[model samples]
Target: MNIAGDDMAMGGMHDEGANKNKSFGERLVSWLGRVHTMVIHFPIAMFIGAFGVELFGLWRQNRDYQRAAHVMLVVGALGAIVAAFLGWFAGGFYLWDRNPILMTHRWLGTSIAIFGIGLAYLATTYRRAPDRSRTVYWGLLGLMTLAISVQGFLGGTFMHGGLNHLAF
Candidate 1:
């Protein structure tokens, strides 16, 4: 009877341990989900705002509006970096091998990150001095705007086309 009691106790302990592990994974997944939602919108908003400023600048030939557009691009790029990090983590945790869409999403996400980092570097270096030219500023804005367009297109494609895995 003593041996039977010992077996039961061990089984109880195993159940508790399993529950704890599961709870930890659940918490991590929940946190990642929240971060994903939080960081994604900022980039979308910033990119749209940057494009608006650029259009407005061209329409009015206002240097101030153009400068605002550059600032918005930089802010959007920074947000993209944060969102990519969280997205990468979540993809690895839950969808890496399970879904082709996740794989395509990861690739597009990485491309977006690289483009954003490059844009940020260009913006920072070019704007570091007080004597930066309006032309240079506009050029950087154009590059950033192009990157944003590509990133947005790829994101949409990944979502709508299922990574191009299915044949129509």
Candidate 2:
């Protein structure tokens, strides 16, 4: 076990070529972090689905929509927490030198995970609330939708280049 090699690899192993000599632990962490991108899709889809369901439910005045939204929120929140942990591990690989964009992405990811949990809890608690309180429920769902959009943009910028770097 080469401790120095592990330490160096963990610092900033950016590409497959650079990872060639990484220690098992270093590689394992990096691999886990890489899973973040794949797993993120689940939460994205779930949260969006929940919002849509709630909206349709509201429009149709059906209690079934709220129940469906609750299920989606719970699943989405759990998925977000898992993805966030993976993101934290993957993000550590880029922290050798300060990258403001990465830091912003990390913080935003964490916030989203925390926010998702809160949203899920609220949704479950109020799932059976009277129609009079639907406004507050919808408001929270709207906030989560907005947060997801902002987080998606930040993730894109962090993964690709910043928006300013776009050709058009």
Candidate 3:
């Protein structure tokens, strides 16, 4: 029962054959590399911008700066989601359990991803009727700031500590 000019089952034939064609290790490595490339980078830029805007807003006490920071935080959160997915996939596929650091990294990455999603939701909702709540925006910004800091620290721990210490 070919449906799209392909002689393969809807869910099995093509996928099974494809899997059989490539060694599992090779496939995993390829997938990890691809997802890693696709997900990393944007989050770094967005978060950096978010941090900057927040600092500027605090210094200037300007509503415009605060709004800009919120926008960047929302964008950064989206990027973090993509990065988290790829990082998670890579960790799982590679069985990155040799060190405790990997677990810490995973937890921190997940936290950042979740926080970002929340921030994005808040930003979207707020955009519709912006003047509704200054407290909400400020609260979200504070959370974003904390998330970014924690993510950064965890990333450093992943790179340097190799999961040796669980101290936060």
Candidate 4:
């Protein structure tokens, strides 16, 4: 195995140039970026809750749950966009080199945000469109759920020690 790959996998390397610059706006943006951790939960919870509500809507024949799910999807999508923007600030622009985990998390988070927005748009058109639209919406929501789970794991690895975070 490549020693360099091992080190990156173990979270042994990070943005070496971090916290070494000197710009007030940059520092403030970085400070705001740190809030990415907290702000991210809104979208996560919203998306999960939206899915739950949709499932309940089917089970209980409650039209209200469907409406609630739609609203949640909108909120979740907006939250995702904001969270991704802040995450970029948090991760910095270019200091990370050859760090796969950070790179993956950064792009994955961004893709999720874009996907969430698309899902949100679909939600808005769910009722007016054909049956295929509903199918696509549900299918995308299921995929989004899976993606969010993976995203959470990646973010968690940052704090808990990469692949071995659960080694007990």
Whole-model lDDT per candidate: 0.60, 0.77, 0.62, 0.77
lDDT of 3 at 90: 50
Candidate 4's TM-score reads 0.81
Model 2 local distance difference test score: 0.77
**Per-residue lDDT tens digits of candidate 4, residues 1-168?**
322222123343434355476477765775666678779999999999999888888789666677789999999999999999988876666545366777788888999999998898888788555344366677789889989998998887764566677677
lDDT of 2 by residue, 77-132 (tens): 99999999988776774533266666777777788899999999888778656544
Rank the candidate models, highest TM-score first: 2, 4, 3, 1
Better of 1 and 2 by TM-score: 2
Candidate 3: regions farther than 4 A off: 1-25, 28-39, 58-61, 93-98, 161-168
lDDT of 3 by residue, 118-155 (tens): 87677667666756765765566666667666666665
Q: Native-vs-model 1 lDDT?
A: 0.60
Q: Weakest 10 consecutive residues, lDDT, candidate 3?
A: 3-12
Q: Per-residue lDDT of 23-136 in model 1, one digit per residue for the tens? A: 676656545644664577788688678777767876896656656766777788888888887776544444344455455566666667677667656656655653676466
TM-score (C-alpha, index-matched) for candidate 3: 0.62
TM-score, per-candidate, Cα-based: 0.60, 0.82, 0.62, 0.81
Model 2 worst lDDT run, 10 consecutive residues: 1-10
